[model samples]
Target: MEDSNGSGRGPTVQDVAARAGVSISAVSRAFTPGASISKKTKERVFDAANALGYTPNLVARSLATHRSGIVGLVMGDIRNPYYPEVVDALSRRLATHGFRTMLTTVWGDITVDDVAPSLVQSRVDGAIIASIADADRLGELLYKNGAAVMLFNRSAATSDKLSSVRCENVEGGRSVANYLLDKGFSRLAYIAGVEHIYTTQEREAGFVGRLMERGVQLFAREHGDYTYKGGFDAALRLATADTRPEAIFCANDITAIGAIDGVRAAGLRVPEDISIVGFDDIELASWPPYGLTTVRQDKAALIESCVDVLVEQIRSGQRTRHIQLVPVSIVERTSVR
Candidate 1:
C-alpha cells in the first residue's frame, strides 16, 4: 500500500498514535464520542488527525457501537410552509438526542423506491418519512434492510405495521365546518390539497361529510396541491360558479392566502361575499397581509414524539411502533367572520 506522498506505507492507527504521543486506544477513544479519554490526549489526537487529513470511518464505528447515529428525514412538497416548520423541528429535536438528520425532498415524479434506496446507500441509522401517503411498500424495503422507520403526518393502512405521529385532521376539519356553519355560512366550498394525501383526504372527508349532514351543500370542490397557485386557480373556479359559496375551507394556510387574493380579484369582500378558513396555521397565516383563520397542528409535540420513537427503535434494534395523534385547534382571525 502507498500513502498519498508515494511513501511505501499506508497511514494506520500506529501512525496517529506515534504523532499524538499516545496509545492506539487513546487515539480511537478521542475520535469516538461517548468513549473515555483525557482532554489533553483528545486534543493531541485531533490535531494529529487534522494534520494527516484522516477522516474517522463510520463503518468501523458502526461495527463497534451497532449504531450509525444518523437519521434520514424524507419530506415532500417543501413549498408548503407547514412542512418546512415540521422539518426544522424534527431536525432540531433529533440533534439534541445526538442524531444527525439526512434530508431528502421527494418531488417532481420521484418514486418511493428511489428515496429509500438512496438513504440506505448512505447508511442512515433510521428514517423518518414526513409526508409519503403511500409508504406501506416503502416501509418493507427499509425494514428488510434493518433500518428503523417512522412516519410523520402520514400513516400506513396495514394495521400495527408501522409507527406514526400525526395531527387529528378529522377533528380539525369537523371543527372548521361547524364553526363556518354556525357563522351562518349556508353555501360552502372546499379547496382540497392533493387528493392522494392521507391527511388531506381525512380533512376533506370530515369537512364535507359534516356539512352534508347539516343540509349545507358544498357548491364546489377543487384540488389545490397545498400550494398558492393551485389554490389561486381553484379559487377563480369556485368564485365564477352561479350561486357561489358563502365561505371556503382551504386545506392549508398558503392556499388560503392565495384563495383570499383570488376572491378579492373577482370583486368579493372576505366574510362579506365569502369567508375563508384554512388548515395548518403556518407562521405566515398570522402575518399582517393575510391574517388567515386556520387550524394549528401542535408542531413541537409532534416533532418531539417522532424523534423519541425513532431513537427508541434505533437503540433497541427493534421497531417501537405506536400511533400518536396530536391535537389540533382552530385559530380565529380576520379571514373569517
Candidate 2:
C-alpha cells in the first residue's frame, strides 16, 4: 500500500526479524504487550525495528486473533461541549484497556439501524451510541448481527432490551423546580433544547409537572435547538415579549450562557431582572462572565459505566442488558437569586 509520503511501501515485520537475528514469532512476542518475551530479545527487536522503521500491522494481528481490539463510538451533536468530553474520556480509558476507538458521526436524519449494515462489515466487537432516532429497530438489528451495544445519555422506550448509562434527568429537573419555587420564582420560563430529545423531554416533564402540582402555570417556553445561538435568539424574543418571564430554566450550560448574554444585551440584570438556571454544569458555566447556576451530571461516573458495560459485553460475548443511571446534583452559583 502507498504511504502518506507517496512511497511504494514501508518496512515489514520480516525485515525486523532478519535484522535482529530472530524468528518472526520472536519479533511478534516482543511487540505484544505482556507477551512472554525475554527483556534482551525485546530490546533487540525494538533496536532493529527503530533502525528499519518497521511498525507492527495491527490489522493483520487482529485477523489472526479473531478480535479487532476496536470499539465503534457513534454520536451526533458534536457542537455540544458535553460530547467532546465523552469522546476524550472513552478514547483514553479504552486505550488503557488495549482497545482503539473508531468514531462515527450519525446525522440527525439517520437512525442507528441505517448504520448497522456498515458496522457489521467493520468487525467491531461492540459499539456505544450517544443517541438513536429509532431505538427499538436498532436494538433488534444489533441483536441480529450479534453485536453487543450500549446507549449513552438516553434510553430506549420500545423495550428494556438495550443497555444504557445516563443521568437522572427527570429527577434533576424536578429538583430545579423545587429549588426555584422555594426561592419564590413565580413567573418561571423554560428554554428547551430540542422538541424530541429524550433528556430534554424528561427534564421538561419533571420541571413542568412540579409547577403543576403547586397550582402555578409556566410563564413562557422557548425551543433552543440545543445550541448557543438558538438560546441567544430565543432569550431575546422572550425578553421583548409583553409578559417578561421572571426566571428562565435552560436545558444545557451553553444555552444558559447564550441566554445570559441575551438578557444583558436587553439591559436586564441577572437574578434581579431575570434569574437563570441551567442543566449540565460545563466548565464555562463557572466562568466569571456567566457564573451559571446549573445541575451537574457526573461525567466521571457516566464515562466509567459506559466503558464497563461495553467491555463486559465484548469479553463475555454476551449481553448483560445492564442499565446504569448516574445521579445529578445542583451546583449553585451567581446566576440564580
The lDDT of model 2 is 0.83
Residue 246 alpha-carbon offset, candidate 2, angstroms: 1.1
TM-score of each: 0.85, 0.85
Candidate 1: 10-residue stretch with minimal lDDT = 2-11
lDDT of 2 at 93: 85
lDDT of 2 by residue, 1-337 (tens): 6742345678778778888999999998876543678889989999999987787888888688666777888877778887888899998988766678888776677666567777777777777878546655665566567767788888877766678889999998899999999998899999998776788899999899999988889899999987899888888888888889989999888888899998888888887889899998888899998999999999899989888778878777788688888999999999997
Per-residue lDDT over 1-337 for candidate 1, one digit per residue giving the tens place of the 0 to 100 score: 6664356665667777888889988887776644667778888998887776666677887788766778888887898888888888888888767678898887779878678778777777788886665576676677778888888887887746678888999989889989998987777889988877788889998898888888877778889988999888888878877878889999988999999988888888876788899988889999977789999998888888888888877776777578899999999999887
Segments of candidate 1 deviating more than 4 angstroms: 1-55
True-structure lDDT of candidate 1? 0.82
